[model samples]
Target: MSYLLRCITCGEEYEPTETRYTCDKCGDLYGTLEVIYDYENIKIEKEFEPKGSIFQFKDLIPATSHTPIDQSIGGTPLYKFKGLLGFDELMIKFDGISFSSSYKDRASIIAVNKAIECGADTIYCASTGNAASSLALTAAGTALRTVIFVPSTIPKGKLTQLLVAGAEVIPINSTYDEVFSLSLRVGRKKGWYCRNSAINPYLLEGKKTGAYEILIQNDYKVPDYCFVGVGDGTVISGICKGFKEFYDLGLVDSVPIVIGVQSEKAATIKHVFDKGKPYTPIIEPANSVADSISVGNPRDVIKACKYVESTGGHFISVRDDEIIDSIKEMSRSTGIFSEPAGAAPYAGVKKMIRSGELKRTDSVCIVVTGNGLKDTDAVRSGVEVKTYDIDEAEALFL
Candidate 1:
């Protein structure tokens, strides 16, 4: 009924201990969500349905509860980014517009359901923007009280979403780690059910749905590469797990390369992979206008690095100017509006093309993790859209 969930760095096995968020031995320093399941008793005789998500292969998910409660969050749109430079079959599975305008909604759906099954009256998490917005909205729907701690750099659109929802949104005027540390302490001290990605392992199950959907949409074929821009590494690790599961099932002949994207200014995952060791986050972060990806000492740096090495992938870093360009390009071309970090994967795609790393035959997918409305200000370098009477507007155009 269970599998030994081990630490990625030390390989220390663990049990669900004392309602704690992570292993006492490792202390979850890498902030990776590790869930191991025993597939021994799972019937090899039975074939898993490939069309749907966790519903198709519920056993692979470590969530204690299986609810068909919501279909809107996990099954996101998978589209092709036609005519990308240096890549012929380049495609992107845009997941930013999930029910709540971010991929975090999927994880919250699963985490909150588990919280409900465990008889929890309250759910808590720490977020920068999208996660907080999604968690608050999900909690409101589930009739659970949510307490979210977020960093102060979050944009107005995201703040507006939280304020409109049923949550006690607290803005922490510090780095992402500080917000997480405070959330961890309060969740432990107050006996609140934790739903934050770094602390709760179950969140990974929901994030894996994005990967699952991508495979299903491609007729059970994995892409050549999957580019994910990281904030906490939860999304990328969850995706790695999903691909590993597919490889185990023989559904895919090979797994896709997992490319981790980061702002060149704040490239923690890149540093650890480049160093070939268990990398620690430096005290200071490189400054970037993309406030969403501005993380110092990301919690999942170690796991992210391991994913890159084992999966035979590269980490691509891009400038904030590139991110802005991506935002504009994505909006103009695909009608997809994304925040700065959300646009970062597109920037990675461009960077790959410029470096001659992309191939014409290789099928690629870049996950847009959040909506542009999350950080509208980041894309405000140019004049905003204006609607006016034809007489005046035409004169200006002339």
Candidate 2:
């Protein structure tokens, strides 16, 4: 159960209590710390059975205590889809069923619990939409106050969730990258606990649980590939970590090839992976219908790239139209509705198959990160709102 924080860039180690976000020596983006557990000393029950809550894997989680939130946080359903999307074996991890109707709840639970554990009264973060709402939902009735900074273009449904949860919403007329920097500065000045998953190491621990659940639900069978939408890169990083942990414990034979799916409009991570270079701050604005993954310069690009490459995975970028089309295709085919970002993985899968990078026989798992209801406006063009009179409706029956 004991662990140490290690800087990914400099390979420096520190006691868990010594630092919060990053390494003091490395600083900022490169200073991002990763939790290194003592795998040799750890032990698990022989008859281990996965449970409905994330707390079931508390032995692997970093927190000593949990928040008093009543709602269940993790344990989303893993559904199988045969002969769908032109794949012989396809599975979707529907994290949209999370408490906040988004996958970000996995990280929010840990962040909120960490805030309380540190005796902090306020928890703040900058998010495109899902993460903000997830944080607000997790800290709703807790003593911790939630403050969210978001772009002005955030969907009304997400804003409504934040307002209903009593979070102090700050809308900035700027890109997500700018808003993120501003939030980091303000959070540091105010000494508030930050829940941004990109910089927070403990939040990654929460996210890795998704990978654990996926493997468990599939009867410990590791899939050939895992496709996830990439934004701040926290979700994919956490997933890779989870699979690595399972592999470390000798539970699974190997890790899946984790493919990160991004919008072509905001494919910073993809570009970096293609170039074989370190992350540099991007100035171009990233505008996409997939608001959640529309990040110009992801802060967690380093870890995201490292983790993906370590598992022999790569990045794929899909067009906005492709993502929109996949939203409809996924919903009609599987009865599972996902936001644009959540559907990006499906689009990427189609693209890869067309490019011959993916084969129809390969077992694939697409992670649906958020619920479709989070951004109904993005799908307006693909759907119709129709009204018919009683007589007109009856004519169709004839």
Best by lDDT: 2
Report the lDDT tens digits of candidate 2 across residue range 284-327: 46898999999987888888989999999999999999999999
Error of model 1, residue 357, in angstroms: 1.3
TM-score of each: 0.91, 0.97
lDDT (Cα) of model 2? 0.88
Model 1 lDDT, full chain set: 0.75
RMSD of 2: 1.5
| lDDT (Cα atoms) of all candidates against the true structure | 0.75, 0.88
Each model's total of backbone clashes: 3, 0
Please give, for residues 281-390, the per-residue lDDT of candidate 1 as tens digits.
45446556666667775666666667666789868788888889999988888788888888888899788877788777888988888888778788786647878898
Residue 394, candidate 2: alpha-carbon lDDT: 92
